[model samples]
Target chain A: GDSVTQTEGLVTLTEGLPVMLNCTYQSTYSPFLFWYVQHLNEAPKLLLKSFTDNKRPEHQGFHATLHKSSSSFHLQKSSAQLSDSALYYCALSGEGSNAKLTFGKGTKLSVKS
Target chain B: NAGVIQTPRHKVTGKGQEATLWCEPISGHSAVFWYRQTIVQGLEFLTYFRNQAPIDDSGMPKERFSAQMPNQSHSTLKIQSTQPQDSAVYLCASSRGHERLFFGHGTKLSVL
Candidate 1:
């Protein structure tokens, strides 16, 4: 079985501060890690993903490094924006033809001015 | 692109009633995925289809949940004897080559 763990229930920060949301996973085999963000009254969209090339994935100023050693793919940003307030999810899809993703509970990020 | 389209943005039904959700995947996409989202459980995988064929549905409730993708353009998920526990937002997503998934607005199902 595959599972993801997001230790933070909610992370609050002021605008321009650094942002970090913890994400760790357990899987039977090496899996594809993903970060999805959902804003208020909107669908969840892909924020970043692990690439086979090993380059850190980044989008909208957010970046994550997939560390197979620690089984972590923590999402980080140097400066938080007001629009960064949303629900963030860490997910993974195991190997093979199965494209289904196992998701973490979710972390609510609130960046205020 | 329209991304993914899910009909009946909201649905409310009584206990034991039946609820059917419709999803239209993006054109030329080869995969369609169903997921349920709730405040308590977050996002949960329900089923998926590739090239109009069922690939995996291990997350579906055996007795009450069923899904079908008779065509590449659209898919349906039906739940019989719906209970309060079934209340959640049902999201439809489509992808190509198992890459980044594009999600729909989702159908919010409320079973009372």
Candidate 2:
């Protein structure tokens, strides 16, 4: 079985402040981690994905390093913006083409001015 | 590309009624996935099809829920005797070679 845990239900931050949303996962097989972002009234979209080569994945000024030892791939941004408000989901997929994703209960990020 | 397409952005059904949701995967994608989103359950995997074949559906309710992928382009999810508790936004996603998935707008199913 595979599972993802995002401890933060909500994260509030002011503009220009650093932000981090915690994500950890458990899996029976080698894991493929992903970050999906959903804005108000919009479908969720891929924010970033882990590379097997160990290169930290980044998108839109947000980055995450997948640490297999810790089972963590925390999302981080150096400077939060007002538009960063959204729901963030951490997902895990096992190896192989038929693998299905297991997602974490999302973290709602609210960036204020 | 148009991405994944899910028909009928919203659906309303009475309890005990049947509802069928449709999904069109992106062209050239080999995988199609279905997920349900709710306030309480968050996001849940229902089923998926790879290469136009059913791969796994362990998350689907065995009694009333069923899914099919008769072709590579389209798939369907049907719920018989829909319950109020079954209400949620049904999302469809497609991926190529198991890479990044692209999700559709989703059909919000409201079982009243």
Candidate 3:
């Protein structure tokens, strides 16, 4: 079985501050990790993804590395923005053909001015 | 390009009623995925299809839930005798490979 855990129920930060949303996963097989962001009233969109090539996936000033040794792919941003307020999800997909993702409970991020 | 499209953005049904959700994947996508999102459970995978074939349905409830993808363009998920516990937002997503998934607005189901 595969599962993702993002313990932060809600993270509140001022604009321009650094942001980090912790993500850890457990899986029976090698897992592919992903980060999806959902803004208010919008569908969840992919923000970053991990590959077996050992490359750290990054997009929109946010970056995350897949640490197979640690089972973590925590999302980080150098500077949080007011527009970053949304729900962030950590997901895990197993290897091979059966690769549907298992998502975390979700972390609500609120960036204030 | 049109992302995943889910019909009936909202649905309200009485208890013990039947509900069906529809999803239209991207034009060239070979993979389609179904997920349920709720305030309590967040996002949970329901099922998926690859190249119009069933891949894995382990996430779906056996008795009351069923899904079908008879064609590449559309898929359906039906719930029989739906209960309050079945209330949630059903999202459809598609991808070409094991890459970034494109999601739809999702069908919000409310079982009273």
Give me the TM-scores of chain B across the candidates: 0.98, 0.97, 0.98
lDDT per residue for candidate 1 within A1-113, as digits (tens), equals 88999998899999999999999999989889999999999989999999977799999999999999999999999999999999999999857877778899899999999
Better of 2 and 3 by lDDT: 3
- Off-target runs (Cα >4 Å) in candidate 2 are none
Q: Which pairs, if any, clash in model 3? A: none
Scoring model 1 with DockQ, what do you get?
0.80
- In candidate 3, stretches whose alpha carbon ends up further than 4 angstroms from where it belongs are none
Query: For this target, which candidate reaches the highest DockQ against the unseen true structure?
Result: 3
Q: What does DockQ come to for candidate 3?
A: 0.83
| Chain A TM-score for predicted structure 3 | 0.96
Lowest lDDT sum, 10 consecutive residues, model 2 chain A, at A93-102
lDDT of 3 by residue, A73-94 (tens): 9999999999999999999875
lDDT of 1 by residue, B1-112 (tens): 8779999899999999999999999999999999999987899999999998998888999999999999989999999999999999999999985688899999999999
What is the per-residue lDDT of model 3 for residues B1-112, given as tens digits with 9 covering 90 to 100? 7778999999999999999999999999999999999877899999999999999898899999999999989999999999999999999999886777899999999999
Docking class of 2: medium
